[model samples]
Target: MFGRFAQFETREEYLEFLNAGVEFVGARDGEPIGRYNVAPGTRVLLLNQRDDKLHLDPVHWGYQPAWAKESGRPPLINARVETAATGRMFKPLWNTGRALVMADGWYEWKKSPDDAKIKQPYFIYHESKEPIFFAAISRFHPDALDAQEDDGFVIVTAASDKGLVDIHDRRPLVMTREASLEWLSPETTPERAEELAHDCAIPADEFAFHPIGKAVGNIHNNGESIIKRIYNPLV
Candidate 1:
């Protein structure tokens, strides 16, 4: 459900990969953007549209608008792609808040057969280890440059089919670079954006998933070692 992800590229590399002429606000150039464990309630680098221009900003990872505050529901790190545009909490951002999450890969937990309490962790990435852009929707501040910690966003997720479902029932809606650019473009209509969510997502076979150590389950654990492929299963 996009609860955890990693981005090991530098700020320059991420921008260059997108190459969309995006303006950076909160982030500085040449900054080391490597993050092995990105959890909820923290700032995440996002490419979003504002003022008729593409921008890169650090927006909070949880999605909880002002209207939903009284409901006492916890902030959501994910929004189902099929319903996010029509969902009560996300409808407001559907038309204008489409965005892209810059992540190298994401993690999912598998319930072990040996024990109910133990959940095995898996790392999912492109087979070739290329960068991925996860589709998202955000409730960003009106001021693009001066984004607040409360201006939050949620990754759009779709139901998994075939083998990937073994890891998790859902996976983030990842798009190709061109489709991702279109997803964030102001010219693209909401109907087309929804279509892209379903039609343009990269297939499960394009990715590979392997079991990893359980240290990633803890938010404090960070480093290349945490993502090392362990031949053995913890469960």
Candidate 2:
């Protein structure tokens, strides 16, 4: 599961990367962003499609459906792609609420076979050094008092590819621009959406990973240093 990630680009860089005339909402000037850790519940940059157009907006990372609040269940941060299309919590949003969670890289912890207590962290990024767009779904809580803050999203995860299976059992559903557009397309049907979710897994060879300091395990630690590579024999 991808619970933490980094997006270390300026607003101009993001615009160039998206290559679309998009609007940015909820961004604060001089705020230390891009080079920090992003966690669940944190407001994050999201690329959503509406009426065949992509719009950039800030949304909460955790997903909370209207029924979940009444059920008193915690927010869902990750949805398994294997069952998302048929799952009770995710099925409703699978087709209509798709989005792209923008990120530079994501963190995964590798458990030590010799020592269960030792869990080493690693930062995984695209080999091309381009941004990774995680396939996700967004929903607006019906009972929300504030629309902006209440809109939430959850990353979709698929079985890890060969290279990353040792580090984790699952990885976020990373997508290319074409795959993302198909995913977020309003014209896409539920069957096609599910098919895309199951088939659009990024190849493991396209990614590179390196061990990082344990500082990333703590939510209090937030900075570029958190993702700094460190030598680890266990890795």
Question: How does each model score on lDDT?
Answer: 0.84, 0.78
User: How many clashes does each candidate structure show, in the order listed?
Assistant: 0, 0
Across 143-227, the per-residue lDDT of candidate 1 in tens digits comes to 5578664589999999998789988899999988888988998898988998888889888999998899989999999998878
Residue 1 in candidate 1, Cα distance off native in Å: 3.4
Candidate 2 lDDT: 0.78
Q: Which candidate has the highest TM-score of all?
A: 1
Per-residue C-alpha lDDT of model 2 across residues 72-170, encoded as one tens digit per residue: 988889999889988888887786788887788998988888887778889999998887789988876433567643378899998887888878988
